[model samples]
Target chain A: MNDPAGAPALSEIAIKPLKHVNGAAHRWVAFIVMVAFFALAPTFIYPVFLMKVMCFALFACAFNLLLGYVGLLSFGHAMFLGIAGYAAAYVAKEGLNIEAIRLGTIHIPLNIALPPFTPELAILTGVLAAAILGYVAGLLAIRRQGIYFAMITLALAQMVYFFCLQAPFTGGEDGIQAVPRGKLFGVIDLSDVKAMYATVFVIFIGGFLVIFRIIHSPFGQVMKAIRENEPRATSLGYDTDRYKLIAFVLSATLAGLAGATNALVFQLAALNAVHWTMSGEVVLMTLVGGLGTVFGPVVGVLAVLGMENYLAQLGAWVTIVQGAIFVICVLTFRRGIVGELARWIKKPL
Target chain B: MTDDYVLETRELTKEFKGFVAVNKVNLKVRRGTIHALIGPNGAGKTTCFNLLTQFLPPTRGRIFYKAKEITGSKPSAIARMGLVRSFQISAVFPHLSVLENVRLALQRKRGGSFDFWRSERILNALDDRARELIASVGLSEFEQTIAVELPYGRKRALEIATTLALDPEVMLLDEPTAGMTHEDVGRISALIRRVAQNRTVLMVEHNLSVVADLCDHITVLARGEILAEGDYATVSRNPEVVQAYMGKGYA
Candidate 1:
């Protein structure tokens, strides 16, 4: 029971706890389902296409971490993806070499000037870079909410895109090309199609799990509370702005992870990565997948990517059809594919 | 009632642009007692609460809790000092399960763990606290119910449980029993009594009988100023209090 001072052991002295909802079981089940789907994805579609789906699926889920869980609708999320892709491509092309020098009397062999371009290192660099950019943007973007929030994020992304266009390192309009897949830890060659497929799948799955863990954590609950009622959360003694900043950074990092993986797979980082259309595309993926459902974005990305691949020749029509889907989903099916399915299943999958 | 004071306001005034919403209102609420603020609509009861909680900056005022000046403090800072106000309408996480809603509030009170890694045991403890509060508020059966799915009365109960989870030293109820069935009103009123025994309570109520039944003291306001302050029986009999409620000239 709480005492007179209003300070009590919240979890320890509480009267009773809720029935345990075995979140671990739910996570394991989801993991199994995702793996099973991935295994079967290549059977019905091109393996490269499947890889692309997984990459965007991870990206959408990351974006959902902010939009769905934290109640932040960031319209400039592509900035993270594109910037990370650029970082990954530039790193791969230059190739890191570590230089070992002998400071003492002992003879040290000559070493490369930078570290090797391993997949893990590339992804790590990408994540860190995205997180830093996200932090800076969140500082500015979090001052407003609702439509203002969306517009500020969009403007910030456009600023980044223009900067990328003029930056010499990004190769301007031509973008980065012939980006090596790079040897994994200087061992496993990613040039092998099957090897590359496995690598991309692992990276996407890893990012997804990281986000899943964040959502289930206590921090995630705080984010949800802030989303539901910010004034209330503030009155409850939380610095809500700080929480939003952290969420933004985390979302950007995961998005960057996905973009980096994509660039490595395709051996190119194109202008599309930094475009506002890319930002819009991810929103659609999250919305179609189910705005807040854990695995909704996976389904959304697969469907959208499939449509794009199959309708390549249609060009402008693809935009029209996608626009129609957005309108239909917003007006009639607000819950989207995963949400409706979750309703049928009676759980927020 | 000198030592009995838990919250006291001295010349608290709130001005919005050029208009004064709450004009120089002085009030004192005893510790562990239910005090009600009653007035005609737009008498500034809500504005007074907002000022005391620091949700709105007071144009001119001083608020003291346990004799410490809290005027012009941030709402969260004030709340952290053991004062919390429940909104007129239900302010809850509707999509979250009833238990999750209460647990989140509790988790916040316990220095919410922002750990993005590791298990959520910190939240598990809050869930335990939430369940207890839910049961105490007669919502044990609806522990897992989504807040949005609950009948109107139950949502009221959930909101109260959440505010209680904040471990407030003084609880401000802004029409806690609003928009409820008579039966539900009785239940919430009973809960209010049980909660008041452990902490000071102040509420804004439109219903005279509800105030008469629950409050030890009632403050009547009209057009941003206190018209009368006394026990319910005394204030109800006051000509000024009657005039304010009846929309007549104050005698």
Candidate 2:
């Protein structure tokens, strides 16, 4: 037998064999349909609620970047999202004031201060922070494979969570609250619900397009190759570790973008963002939509957030319902909603 | 100082715990010649192949490729230096199409850019070459088929095509015909012969007929050591080679 340990798992096998049928046309149609739906959604659905769903959708897409394409299971991805939220919130509330230090010989007073950063700058800062954190975390985590990789990421994330909990900036239990939405580029006021919703819609669409591009890029092709057969990829002269690390950083950065947007949308950065349960939630969303399917995360986030919104009255029963959905999806529709749809259409989503 | 050889190993050894898998084995493959490493089931052929490819690091030894010491180099770095190896098992990306598989290998030759913003249509430039490779391997008809869905023989053919896409200077084939039908063996033999014309081919093969037909040089190994080394005709007639194959009492 071939290397059984190296072979993908049975569940992973089910997700393989992507079929592309009129791929470009299908993607265009999907994009149009999504934009149309978002355009009309505010008239019937609540704008704030839609913004929340979009935030989670972007988050799930970012998480799927590693799990679906790269075959990495990161149980600690919430740390990126959570850290980004804190960073964005801090920037929005207190702004940035970097004081330059004077060394022994050279006196370099490179002090800079910006009072209350714009929402765009704050989000950019959050994304950059996440990318850096991803580099450090990925450097350590990618040394191992499969379960060990997942464990290392989770442990590191837990460390970050503890840091946030103890750190004075995070406000311990209450978190950084009432963070100002700030102006967009110091021009457009984000205080208006419609304006904020429009910004989120654009961000979601932008993030979604970036992910779609990644899945269809040459780099993405190599990433999938590494996922399918890593040793073979190495033999083909790809430094697969570097590719995986870059992919991890990219995924984390996108997740951070989602988190920063969410913090601005809700005017808060709370412990719930960094909690382990957030990681599980993203996983569930990705799984429900489809592990590797392109539009699966969007469908998944909507389904999950919609259930949470409607089932709010059921209290603890919401968790039970979500669990039931997860079970049903795994047992019957393992390919996920969008995955099954893609399989049926014989096209890559 | 001789540069006639493409690959050479000096006293290459690998140990699992205390047992030696490949012990003090020296090998050399002349430039642009087809060489075969043959041994019985427990003769450490695959282990030796792995050591050369840097898949498994040697316990103690030195490996040289193109007159450069590469014992400590990474598998990927060696591949970049034009020393590539295939697996005993079909190593094609199961989900990618045959064309995409070859194209992906070709993409490595293009450039290393982690640019996620650019569209993959830029890869269409590589499609012509990828198609040529697929056609060379007689897999043009199955270019669009997902690799996992292809028949076992066809999948192996795709693996070869992908490997060839890299245009490797020294191609190491590990049991290219390990689990194939007679027809597949013939086709793959022909493919290997054609691809080896411009490059050095080092193969670990169990089929003696393939070795005799294709190999310009043969090395017979037994009990983690080289037993005979020469052309197939000369090595096949070696008394120890006969004993290694026929067993001591039978010989």
Candidate 3:
């Protein structure tokens, strides 16, 4: 039997239909709430610690972009963090106000052009570098999926750690210290910690917004399709690999944004920035916060960073605690804090 | 009418090591006919389907759809050309709601595929298309159900409905009635007939009765070679077809 020629359209029904699997009003409300918290946080907490929290929160958020949205678990995100940190630190501290005067067949100026590099320039460089590295790393990591993908990232991160340790530009084990925060457009004094904190907050929020937009977009649908079934996505005429690679680069660029901010905020870029442990830390943050939810990483970063602030004197006990939390998350809290709460509320967090 | 034949394979051959899975196969499917490819197990039915759809590249020959050669084309490219193949088993987004799964496919079908900013509108629009597809496939009652949560027969029906969301000119279904109960089979058979009214359908089925009842023509394949080809009555009585099914003719 043929379908009726003129029927009431499927669009004109009782229910308007859920436009998105994740609710729009809920997400918008969440964004407003997050902005309110970010605005009020400085008044209640120490500015430096709050700044540090903001930096790590941004870092964790960037890390979550790959793991949560794309369903890719990365273990070497620290490469982007560390590389960008060192690069920004080096540019701010030594490279910015250098001289080029003639010295024994080498023309180096005595008074270098003091056109001080802006924060925007530093962050842009950081994003570009991270995207490039991510392109290369993702090409290799995406060749294998699931647990194998994690292992490949972990191994590559170890290689980066060793490279940073041996490379003289990175200052070997000492790293580049006394990194100047530099000007916010060659005008604002970044030494004013409040201004710096505001700057970091803006970058973090901007990066977060871009990520939110992406995950909610049509491009994001392809990613979910790839995550669910790559073969079927391919059969549906989607270039799945390119989508994965783009996701990887986007995640890395945001991670680099966090790294550049970290370098500026602390006035130092250390070997610890690139270490495998740092990579593991971000994974722990995402896991404890929520693996797939939007605001999960922020919660995760705040929790982990808060613990670190109090337990800094506990030495290796912090590592032990972090490991325990990871185990707990894997075995008991597969949904993480936010994920479980969302389930209880019967709404997406 | 030249463009109406949605799928055509010319001397398509697939060889794995020394074994030929599909050999010198030429297939022509009209734009809106439920073309059934019925054969015994291992008659290269699956392989031929795969080759025509470019799941596996043919060692020899080419495939054309809508007057365009599709040899060596990627599966996604072929699908984008309005030809989509559903696996024998159910293929669906299990974690997503039935409406969401269909909407995703509809989003892909529309040119608004890359627009992340406007997905909300597109997905909203797709619900109507999804509902129509669901109703067409006799799944209107379960429109909001999760695909994986559905019963086995229902899941298969959902898979077909999901494929329809692509608005394909030609649909390749491998064993659309496999492992189905008698009632379920009859329902699916009717649905298939309805869908085939306006779209080309190429399916492989072991259920001979379903073939006899639904198919416009029959192609019998034995050991990767065409054994018989004609209407159901002619092919069913062909000596080679009887020999392949029964193992030997009775004296």
Top lDDT hit:
2
Query: In candidate 2, which residue pairs clash?
Result: none
lDDT per residue (tens digit) for residues B56-173 in model 2: 9999999999999999899999999999999998898887778888988999887684777787778888889988999999988887777878899898889889888889999999
TM-score per model (chain B):
0.94, 0.97, 0.93
Q: Candidate 1: list runs displaced more than 4 Å.
A: A1-30, A95-116, B1-4, B126-128, B249-251
Model 2 DockQ class: medium
User: Using DockQ as the measure, what is the rank order of every candidate, best first?
Assistant: 2, 3, 1
Question: Ranking under lDDT, best-scoring first?
Answer: 2, 1, 3
TM-score-sorted candidate list, best first: 2, 1, 3
Choose 1 or 3, whichever is better by TM-score: 1
Recovered fraction of real interface contacts per model:
0.60, 0.70, 0.49
Q: Poorest 10 consecutive residues of model 3 chain A by lDDT?
A: A1-10
Query: What value does the TM-score of chain B take for model 3?
Result: 0.93
lDDT of 2 by residue, A303-349 (tens): 99999999999999999999999999888887778877876776667
Q: What DockQ does candidate 1 have relative to the true complex?
A: 0.34
Which scores higher on TM-score, 2 or 3? 2
Comparing 1 with 3 on DockQ, the higher-scoring candidate is 3
Highest TM-score against the true fold, candidate: 2
Q: Which has the better TM-score: candidate 1, or candidate 2?
A: 2
Model 1, residue B79: distance off in Å is: 2.2
